[model samples]
Target: MSEPKSYIQVLSPELLGRVFDAYAHKPDEEKHLIGLETTLFSSCESGFYANPVILSHVSKNWRNISLDRPTLWSTMIMVRPIASHIPKVENWLERSKTAPLTLQIMQTIPDDDTPIEPLREERTAVNTILEMLLKHIERWEAITFFLCIGFLPAFAEFPQGKLDQLKSATLNLATWSTHPQVVDRVFRAIHAAPELEFVSWCASFFQTGLPDHVPWQQLKRIELDVNDISEEPSSVGYVLDILSKCPQLTSAKFILGFCKTTTPKALNTPLNLPNLRSLALDEASSPNIAYVLQNLTLPSLHTLNLSLFSDEERSSANLFKAVGSLVGRSKSTLKYLGLDIDDEQLLKLLPFAKDVEVLRVGGAKTKKFTSLLTRNANNKISLEVLPKLEYLHLTYAQDAMRPHRISASTAALNRMVVFRTSQPPATPGLKKLKFISVGTAASSFQTAHITLILGTYSHLNLKSVRFEGN
Candidate 1:
């Protein structure tokens, strides 16, 4: 009745689910086999979620077992087949009796060209059910909490009066519409409660109604991610005005934005969040790049990832230059930096940071970026410039990967480790090389690497060459 097992592994697509069925239906003996951590089909995205919910349809036995794996059910957010998922998830909650659950919900923004906030047919139904569930679970003393929604602002309207029940929450509504109101309500609710500790709003919390300064001595971490700062004053900078007042705060997130001198400060005084341990700052527009770089001051900041992932070309180059110029200015507090600038940008930053130990840059994006600075000067992008540089990372593409040589003599370059897609560039001063994406296979990488290895370095007594995915 069954074909002989083939060379290729033919595990049943529903193998895990079927096993789960046996455990949930029969008790005791087999229960240990179907643990909560069983791998579900997550890669197919829609199908992954669908399979779990659909399993309930096959038999009542499945319905009961599926509930045991709360992780799988909670992982279900917004997706196709959610219409069918409604009843299944509702049933799971009904049986769960509000024991307290943390839901992760998100809306994928397919791409830039995709229309903003395109309404799906079931948007209202889904939101209505989720909100009702939030209220109902609280009523039943059921522990259900959080219907975390992402990319969808309408979801903000769901928990309306029931936010008091949530344990942890994240609100990242980027639009100005009613997002501020949602943030206002969420922040007020959290401020009043002792149970709720973790709260991150995609909208700026300090920028809104609680005043540019709140008596937030109790606050620990605060993040303000700005999507449109260059646009005519969306709430980004308004939030910063309020954030300046959150003194003694521990962690902070700032989205670079500017305010016109004429416009009143969203709050009267400058906001300072002291005792920050980690921080993330970004710039979508290039205009404020200079001011943002100059204004960035984190005394206790240990980890840093400065970025310029902008689509603006002309402003991008200038932004890159500004970011580069700010590097060495800080007193070497940064342990990590995720830079998305080009060669010209890196060269400008070299003189600034004397103690920067770790650096991660895009693959061959370095070449195009590197080419900018060398355009006028010698073709050298080297350690003489970055005297204290330690780890150097490159994001490589299918094309050949190489870096501009500043000086083949600096001891720092000699100590630097290179990670790339193409074979490592051989340099006399180069120390260690790690190839992240080598071409074809291990066999082919050898000859190409051999030729590249011999051709890359001078006879200045170089370090060893490594084949990565080996």
Candidate 2:
């Protein structure tokens, strides 16, 4: 008699194919099964899924299934491309057949005090990989580059309009190296792509300012970050000038460096963005973000996030004032608001965003804010303060050496929730609070405190109430 068939050998090809397909696309947490180890090309990053190369080595059946699935090899993320990666990259490209590719090439900057210098071998490896990828440029769907400035020349040779299938591109320089001409060529090549809609560029804005040849009219989303280590800061006028050209933008984020320049004179008419729905502005330690807010009219905006690192009272007050004026001028119905400001300023700004359904406050003293939400002796919540709010998240600043301070007492938080939910069902324009999260320093809130709060409110049917200590 023939030897007993093994369990794997008995499965039909159809079933094996389905199993391989599911295994290849499982979530990162679930991909740590017995046989899935780091192959030659697997990324150890948190979000990346398991590599298909390991499956191909499991058995002849598995190998055939994996090799036939082009999509299984389409996404390639190389943390730091090296000479050893060329063969595996070539293999992946061959297996991927004609499927579109999503590529992420990153080289993290060292955190130590040592000066940065790109190794010659690393540059050569990167150029080899680029040459291989450019051969299949028409199959590129999305690409991300977080590399040293030396690699910019490798991209200078990219042919214009060859990225016919590209939709998104992220180019971030991890060093202070500046090569404007190479940067311009890279931008021009990307701008010529017919289908590109999103672009994120992080670099030293003072040296390599916004490229003059971006496909601004076709871009739907854009994120610009000014390098933090640069000595010179970007001005508000320069940023506003860039925005004026992108009339089709629906989402925009600017992480501006320190800005010492005075606010440019207001546009004869505020720059109108009727289609923009989300806008975020952050400054390292400057109040100049107010100038950006002061100069724009976003009639379609529903989400706004403002973060200013300065702790000066004057800066906080001015920033909040500009926010309120912009809200009133736009008359846009805001559905989400995020602020990194003092509690007092937050109180002043909430009245302008009465339609806000989600509120996120970070690095704020929350005692007063929670009190404002609590019911008065008459058991009535103020109609002016986030009456439509459904979700609230508060994160407090913490120092490592000092003891944790409770920003909002458990009583205040519980009372705020109870009052917000106790409103009459027939109350017009009020939404029942559904979720609340309080993230604080370690030991600020105990596990029992969160359990008690949840147990007491079980009847209210709150979706989630979480207290996280860090």
Question: What are the lDDT figures for the candidates, one per model?
Answer: 0.42, 0.71
lDDT minimum window of 10 residues, candidate 2: 31-40
Candidate 2 residue 98 Cα shift, in angstroms, is 2.2
lDDT of 1: 0.42
Which of the numbered candidates is closest to the native, going by highest TM-score? Answer: 2
**Which numbered prediction scores highest in lDDT against the true structure?**
2
Backbone clashes for every candidate come to 26, 0
In candidate 2, what are the lDDT values of residues 1-470, reduced to their tens digit? 89999887888877776666566555554433222123224522334456788888988778888789887888887765678889988998999899999887765444455245535566677778888888898999898877763544556665776788989998765353556556666667778888999987766334546656778889989887654424576566766877888898899887765665466677787888989999987643435667778888988999998766545422544666787778788888889998866556777777667788998776554678778776443544475577789998776435332222336767777788888776666566677788987665333444554665566676776899776653
Q: For each candidate, what TM-score against the reference?
A: 0.52, 0.78
Error of 1 at 462 (Å): 16
Per residue, candidate 1 scores C-alpha lDDT tens digits across 1-470 of 98797532353435555565443333332122221122222212221233345655665655555555543343333342235546755765555453454444343323456444443534444565566455553332112122223323443654444444554456444443445566555456545544443455553433442333233555566555543323444444544544455566566666653333232323332233446556555543344434444444555656655544443321433644444444434333655665544455555654454445555553224333333212112234443333334454443323222221222222222223222111225433433322212222211223443335334444423233332321
In model 2, the Cα lDDT at residue 411 comes to 74
Q: Candidate 2: lDDT of 328?
A: 80
